[model samples]
Target chain A: MGHHHPGSVSPLRTLTAAVRHHRDRNVGPVKTVKLPRRKLDFFASVLQRFGELHAPVARNGHFVFQRVRRWSEARLEYTRTELPPKKYFLPPRETLFRFTPGKGYVPESEDLDRRIVLLGVHACDIYSLNILDLVFNGKYPDPYYQTRRRNIALIGVDCIPDQRCFCRSMRADTVEQGFDLFFYDIGDYYLTLVGTALGDDMVLAAGELFESVTPDDVAEYKRRSQERHQRFQLDVEIRDLPEIFEMEYGSEIWEELGAKCLSCGSCSMVCPTCYCYDVADETQLGSTAGRRVRTWDSCLFATHAAVAGGENFRHSRASRVKFRFYHKQRGFVAEYGRPSCVGCGRCSAVCPVGIDIIEVINRLRGVEYAETEHAATR
Target chain B: MQATKPTVGIFGLTGCAGDQLVILNCEDELLSLVDVVDIRDFLMAASGGDEFSTLDIAFVEGAVMTRRDEEKLQRIRRRAKALVAIGTCALQGGVPAMADGLDWPSAVRDVYGPEGDGFDALPARALHECVEVDFSLPGCPIEKHEFLGAVADLLNGNPPQLPTYAVCTECKMRECDCLLVDQGRFCHGPLTRAGCRARCPSYAVPCVGCRGPVPDPNLGSAMDVYTSKGWSPEEVVQRLRTFGPLPTPVPAGEAA
Candidate 1:
């Protein structure tokens, strides 16, 4: 029912043990283990024994990560999920505290010790999770988020870039770490790379299903990675994006975008790294006792910037639109040394009005032009 | 000392009494609600003599279409301390308000006869237009949870917090695939107010703007999306008009 705690040993001893384990097998820290296509179900079933299993599944012609009981339910070949894996860590709504009228509040902390294995996560979403880690785990760490992150294990899968995906431009098309295990499709088998000790534990649990990878298999894995790199349909030059955003602060493009913005907050809702939230108290009918809950909020909403004095910081649609972009592209980088956007394309895919991030970035760079025909007709 | 329960009334005017029925649909919570509020007037669920003297809170549903409907609404507004417009009809005039664009007299005559079949008719108007409405709970049929929550908030001397965001927000939370983006369907989710938990999208149907538009919807952009997807400007307006006409009128014969 439980596994040995890695923390029980000293950091030096743990590293030495890992090194000894790898040397004993004559493998590098990044070893490629061959998983035969037929053994996927057996492997998933074995993984399920470790924790609550979740994977992407086909729903209403789109993919969404949902709890899966069977291996067959996991749609491993899907391009993108309607919602990112962020929901597992930071749910849409969660109770923060409960309070009675006279009595003070009692914090409703979650039990984060329960094991959860998220399978079939794409590279961009994994990168997004890493960005979230920097936000929630940095400075004054959020205990709730930190605990949930500690309990969950991420399993990454190589994704075939769709027309909407621009992860390559963000340098998030492939991840080196932050995942327990990463799977790459190499013809008849999956070349699985163990990224962490937890991944090594998983491999040991289902050792029979995996075989030591040969040199030929490693070559095939590298060739497949190269092939996927060229398949991306969208690209954005992100090196000087922060500078461009700074210069384009007063660009007319924002006003044009604001005119088309629905202000629905769908873009933020679907974005993996957008973690803005609002808290409210919900009391029971005819009772003084209630729970304070936190729900996902968006800066795009009109009331998001409103204060008690009726002063709204970002009053106009243009300001809100610009603020959202600048926050993701420039502001985050100034604070975190990296842009918050992982180029997952969920925002573009979910936007009702077809506001693509790549187009916005390219237009900002003066490399592309907006469709003037539509604007002129309007 | 036991606290006196607040007197409440539930009334309907000129549309399908679906919203009141939704209140009845809250079978589990209905009993608890009854224990909390003193329901003085509720015609749909329970039959009682009209005691419209003074109500702590009144939930009025349906649109005010006729002279009698307007008078009844005014009477309710006078009696009730706080009037909450429940359902799309009372909030935005609902589907019945579509007749506002047409010649009412001719439409009424065509429906009935030259010698009118008795009841006087007028253009469908929202309750707020006729009387002072304290709050509004908007939806095709008001969501049961929202209705109950509003009632609870009023009982607790708290203003009921309503969602200002569009249906697209809830649709995204439900993780439903964007019909407009994926299939190029004319979904009104972006423009329409939420609080229905995106029921239509969850069931694979596009939002029909039945909950009415959000506070500051960019209709121009919404129409642009539709027109770009090959939908005619007339088609877009027709769809928008299905629930009720927007506050800013879509120009006549203009391709969006």
Candidate 2:
């Protein structure tokens, strides 16, 4: 269902810049390393010099993104990680301060000063993280998160000629500019496109490391990315997703998911973009030593919103389940013009219950079964 | 610092203790709160003071889970010039109420030792269990910001203006594609209250109905949303049943 054109690399391409500012050193824009794929030395050099580089590192039977000091530790090619690359921003829990008898309060917030380059980020994770950026960087920007974000740079790599991926369905197959720089593994050398000024500065700074993309490099990157797009396993007609839910607002599917839902909040936890949180005040041993802290919150919690008059707004597991999906898929996008779910596939992949997001979205659209058969079941 | 201040007491009951934790989270404005409100008792936080005079303002959390708790709540109500319910546990019975399922006896039996006759509880009255509650601020643990807003409002001689709308409305305003329509996912935003600003949804989490049902929520529409998500009718009713410890068959501000 696609074609290969001679020069239309509009969908995907690799380009350098006049003033690219990629950072290789922890302090400056990235210093490029233009070595062959096997030249692990280049990678080693980057990680070694930085002392801190976080990329997709395998761990716990599932691929988890972690800090990497060497090339061997980095896993460039992967299907999906157990967790999306969200922990990089809003950590699971963070203490805001410590307070006691009110003589003085202590703020224990820390910002990671060491620069981190996130490698092998999937488009979905990119999309999801973008939503997070929009949120944390909203009206009142979160100083804690912003400090780290400004120091870090995102490096996105396309999924290896797909075994299976639903990023396209979730509208995340292609990067619409979130990364400071993008890398498409094109055989010998990475076809890199400097995205932000930081990216351009880095690329320009490393004039010797990265070669300008010739016509051939651009062509190869396109061919490979397109092939993957066509072959990608999940095909969701997402344009009409909102309409599907609108029509099925009375559907029985919600309760079904709810019934099986452990309400464990695992799905939300693994999600790259799920950032709902709760702020708490932790007093030290005395009334004086405590600080306000923030931790991840789940909608599945039954008491999320109940009033004194004894009214429980969303008390059902189904409702919790429903609210999570609607908020991500539709509500969030409508409000922020950003899709909350970056299609990182972490939620379904790590779900103990085996609820696949792709499957759920398809079902929402009434994937199969005629009206009669469906009606009979109902 | 301000010269004089109003006396306020904050308390909690059976939920996850999230509400108390939330208010305690008011970091920047905390010292100010401590200065302004003379907190007499906060079961979750402070060891508590005993003078227990008429409180200018009383902040209560969690549902009435015990006889002692009921008595404590009544005392708070009677003694406080103003009372505010903070959190789902205090406002709506919270999760414990979900287990009630109308058949209070069976619900109790489901818990306790056996024969529905074990450590006698005041026969759990419809999850709210007992006591008269004044103002209500819902949320698993009241949103720290919202809790502050409510407190601040009270200080300004105006109660916090909580959103009485459904979660779905906020979701829509957030421009989140309907989860049910876009991705066959079930969400109770349509029937849940606003105020949390639909945080869960934007975070990519579903509405769990922790906020409790909205005023005159369209149970019928909510059930229909579930159907589209491929849930069975039985599942829909079962879901709705869990949230309304004491079903709000009528609209908010209307009769039971």
| RMSD of each candidate relative to the true structure | 7.3, 12.6
Q: Could you give candidate 2's per-residue lDDT for residues B1-256 as a string of tens digits?
A: 4235677788765556788888878788888778666677776676756446778788887667677777777888788888888877677676666656456666667776476575445433322446555678888867876776677667756656565556654553343444544455666666677777678877767777778876545454445446656788766666665544634233212322
Model 2: per-residue lDDT, tens digit, A260-358? 554545567667777766565544311234466665556765545554677777877688788888888778768786557766555664343455667
TM-score of chain B of each: 0.93, 0.85
Give the lowest summed-lDDT range of ten residues in model 1 chain B. Answer: B247-256
> Which 10 residues in a row give candidate 2 chain A its minimum summed lDDT?
A10-19
For candidate 1, write residues A155-217 as lDDT tens digits.
Answer: 888988877777887888888878888888888898898888778889999978899899999
Tens digit of per-residue lDDT, candidate 1, span B35-83: 9988889988788746655889999999998898998898888989999
Alpha-carbon shift of residue A335 in model 2 (angstroms): 0.8
**Model 2: residue B247 alpha-carbon error in angstroms:** 24
After superposing candidate 2, which stretches have Cα over 4 Å from the reference?
A: A1-35, A47-51, A100-106, A161-164, A204-207, A307-311, A369-378, B1-256
Question: What total of clashing residue pairs does each candidate reach?
Answer: 0, 101
